[model samples]
Target chain A: MNTIALLPHQQSPAVELDYTTFQTLLRARMKQAPDREFLVFPETDRRFTYREFYEISVSAVDWVGRQVEQGGTVCIIFRNTPEFLAIFFGAVALGITVVPVNPDLAVPEIRFIVENSGSHSVFFDPDMKGKLVPLEAELPEVRFSPLADVSELPKVDVPAIEAQLPHVEMTTPAAIIYTSGTTGFPKGVILSHMNFLVDGKGIAEWFQLNADTRSLCILPLFHNNGLVVSLASALHAGGAIIMIDPKASLRSFWALVERYNATFTSVMPSILAAILALGSDGRPGYLKGIISGGQYLPPSLGKRFESRFGVPIFEGFGSTEATSYSCFQAYPAERRAPGSVGRVMPISEMKVVDENDMEVPDGTEGEICIRGANVAIGYHNLPELQALRFRNGWYHCGDYGSRSREGDYYFSSRKDDLIVKGGEKIYPAEIENVLCMYPEVTECATIGIDDAILGQEICAFARLKEQTLVTESELLAFCAQSLARFKQPKRIVIINHLGDMPELPKGPTKKILYRVLRDYYERRLANSQDPEGLKWVLGSQGGG
Target chain B: MTIPELYAALSPLAEQVLRIPQFDKTLTMMSTPSWDSLRHVQLLSAIEQKFGIEISGDDAFKLTSAEKLVQYLHRQTEGKPQA
Candidate 1:
């Protein structure tokens, strides 16, 4: 185990949060401002004040207590709904770990998480009956309960349930978030209550959040960005949050922000791209800034969005391992660097280290590592992976980046995402960033393909702007102007050329799945027939 | 087009766009795992193309269930020439 320490400058009241567990925080918020609106779900037009949310959570405590014990784990599968949070808060308050699974995942994937987490019961939304009903028989040991609405939870005595709630320590595991692994099954990241509280406090402090801070949650609650950055941060600050179903909220993003007076919202880069693609004109209203992370935010895209919408995007860098974000761009727009993710937050320490875990000099690219109370307890049920990743008192982030002399961190690429061609290393972001500068390119991704001689070749996939026509050859020429000859793509695939994939293959959060693109290149473009009319501009047949 | 007629016309498109085994009245954004936000947009776009009409963003998200979609389309195509 690694010793956790606060940074030297942890002086902000937000950073010096005294509450230990989530329950304590929630109780404090309720006591401070019981009448203040805490969570608002626009899809169902549901609003819950702090007191109401606490009451519902108490109901959930009683409801889940009947099924699972204090030390057991429960899986909650629901879209961004209050029911999900209620169950989550209930389970964690009772010292039971809650595993929140994305309901959109295939049944097999869902089963893998439930079984791997060894969850005793799964409290799923009634809407997922078609999927979970069949799993009950398959996993006979696990109890499957459908919770359609918070109203369905038996109205239990709030005081009695609160009194009987187990004494949960700050170190008690709160949730096991399973990140989509690059290779086989996804690994479960065990986040304790202290991790959530510390990370949430860090975000709250970094953003300078207060009771007036209204967060419009456009991301799914299952992810750390939504959980900590949006929900937990707001809770820590006694702020209000308007939660909407991520899928259903894209078109209404501006409207919701304006209606709720949302001062802050967290989203992925793809969401920003999607909103930009909408081409609808709207004011930013009270929206102070957009928090972007979970993937690389192309500097061009970030600049374009900020210029167009007049809202600064505070792009950060972190993984599920460090809760949501460990570092973020400086607040108060004028202080931000143009292309950096920003300096490390005061709650954590971030250092770029080489393969041997030695600190690299400034302006040198190396793997990014984080150490702080915010770092997770480690992966669940995977001791070997835990040992490998969380070693030497630092959580190896597996992302390659460098810190500038000014202390600004620039994320280069994922360690695995690096493309080495002809004995020279290249980050896909290098080429993708250049491609995005083109007028018609809305979003793009670059990946390394298997090359017989060079070990890997470059392939770029681009999604064009709406109703825009740019041939692959033209894009290739455009890329040739900006990128080096060695780094230029050998092939460019217009992803939406034939309308087969109207959008790039993405995960639930809309992060572009480069592995899926690699597999597509291997199976469809390289191996078999090109039925989808993937417009591949092969620039120079062999190595670039 | 009546609701049932609209439903009949939408069944195949929903199945294709959503990639579901079948489409039923009970199928909704909540009930159907495959009918995600992206597919919802696709389904709406396909409906717009097939019926030669446009669905505004405001009305699009409200049409979650198959029943709601058929009703919404019936109103959209009513008193208008359908493609």
Candidate 2:
């Protein structure tokens, strides 16, 4: 199987940063470094040089300009392919707002993002095109283009800007990335160009990113963790980026490293652990460093990866609302300390604050409050939720953590209903909402279980609309197709029949009882594992 | 103790367990889909248990093929010739 032999020849990293507008920067880099390879997909043996990428992207920009309004929102539904980046920067060049959607999102989740954002046009890959086609009848007047059509369309000349506005300032809204909240509905986090650019600069500075930093992007582009950190960091440093399939990432990872001469990248703990588990031949090239975020990397796993690979796995703490990274463990020595998320970045001010917005002492866990240029411009159209999360000048991340005497921060848990299973956070409402889309599912509830590994796992309970027999594996597979891997439920509890239902709590104002379902699952888990009861409760279709 | 002999020995099992034919016949760890980052640990554990040989951390991280694993095991076994 010696797959490494299947990849293209490896090349040294060549950083040639050109600043200005993204289009101008890209064009200049291409002209200056015409022969240097920029992006590569090892599995497909697809490689693009700076000159080639710029030429194709310019044509894409011209094509998109004709299809979309100037400064209008252009919806994008695609995985982390070369075309995804091409289209993303293409839209940005025309001064159009880019709205990214997770191609793996369920039907309801995808519909919400499209409707709420009021996108004038959408660009979807083949995988996501079928899903959106069914919803086209529901919403008229919105233009759609398959990503396959972009390359085949007669390459258009770079169109002139009809009405030039001042360069998209640091304040200009760059993207609207949808993230789920405790309430179940996903909220569009408005991050400006400044937010991502500032964070990219901070991360690049922290890692000492230079032209010699070739990076591997195995993370999903829709998430801030992948887009802003891995891809943007490489681009900002004038380094080359290599994209790989998430499903086959581990198998192709080392070949990508040898093929690209990669020096750095960001990954989730799960991915890192998977790489480490591959034993010896799976060992990648000698990278300068690797950054882990999106979830906590257990100290044991981090130590094993560093000790074995001879390179460190530096942990970072951040959120979509915080533009990817707020704090980072910059060096290997810093990573030795268990549970530390490193000190706050220089561009940001972090505080461990009490419920009353008062700063708490060192070693005492409290709400992690961040004040920085990297903070998002609040949630779109959720004034009340935004007001609750923001206090004074700091954006209170609904996550509990503590700052050490040395200024390092350690995560405790979420203050909301977010379940970070593996590396991705699964909002119960998001899963429950998706489950309702199934024809057989009448009502559903989602919860988390304490796993020996993976920290937590998604567990779902469903009451069928009729007497339908559905297996747990079917539901799990359904979730895998509809949602991202981390958001997929690890187990499904099927309720055969719905008897006289228990009285759910009433929200003084009129709201669905999301809590009632949660409590039921929580009780089931508590009772099943109760020490007081001598009986070992094996599974017989119970929640949790 | 050499890589070729190791490949000869483990080739059948690697094929059967991984369901990937022509695996250990001429493949590295990176060649098989079942030998992914997560599955690699389980595979190594199975190998270590089957051979009753303690795989060093460096050797464990570096062994990409049955041949490599066998070479490392032979060296390890040679280092303690008395047994």
Residue-level lDDT for B59 in candidate 1: 68
What would the per-residue lDDT of candidate 1 be over residues A1-544, giving only the tens digit for each residue? 1233432222121334488888889988999999999998876778999999999998988888889999999999998888899999888889999998877665666888999999979999887887677788899989998888899888988888888988887778999998745443578999988889989988999999999999998787887788998999999999999988876776667777777899999987767765665565658999999998776666777787788889999989888898879999999888999889988988888899998999999999999998887888888988888788888878898999999999999998776776655333466777877788899999988888765324467888899987787899899988765454556787898887644667778999998887888887787677533322111111111111
DockQ of every model listed?
0.25, 0.04
TM-score between model 2 and native: 0.73
List per-prediction Cα lDDT, in the order shown. Answer: 0.80, 0.68
For every candidate, give the share of true A-B contacts it also has: 0.23, 0.01
Cα lDDT tens digits for candidate 2, A298-332: 78878888787677778888888888988987564
* Docking class of predicted structure 2: incorrect
Q: Tell me the TM-score of candidate 2's A chain.
A: 0.81
Candidate 2, superposed: residue stretches over 4 Å from native: A1-21, A24-34, A153-166, A332-336, A434-445, A451-455, A461-488, A494-544, B1-83
Q: Quick one: best lDDT, which candidate? A: 1
RMSD of each: 11.6, 11.6
Q: Supply candidate 2's per-residue lDDT for A488.
A: 70
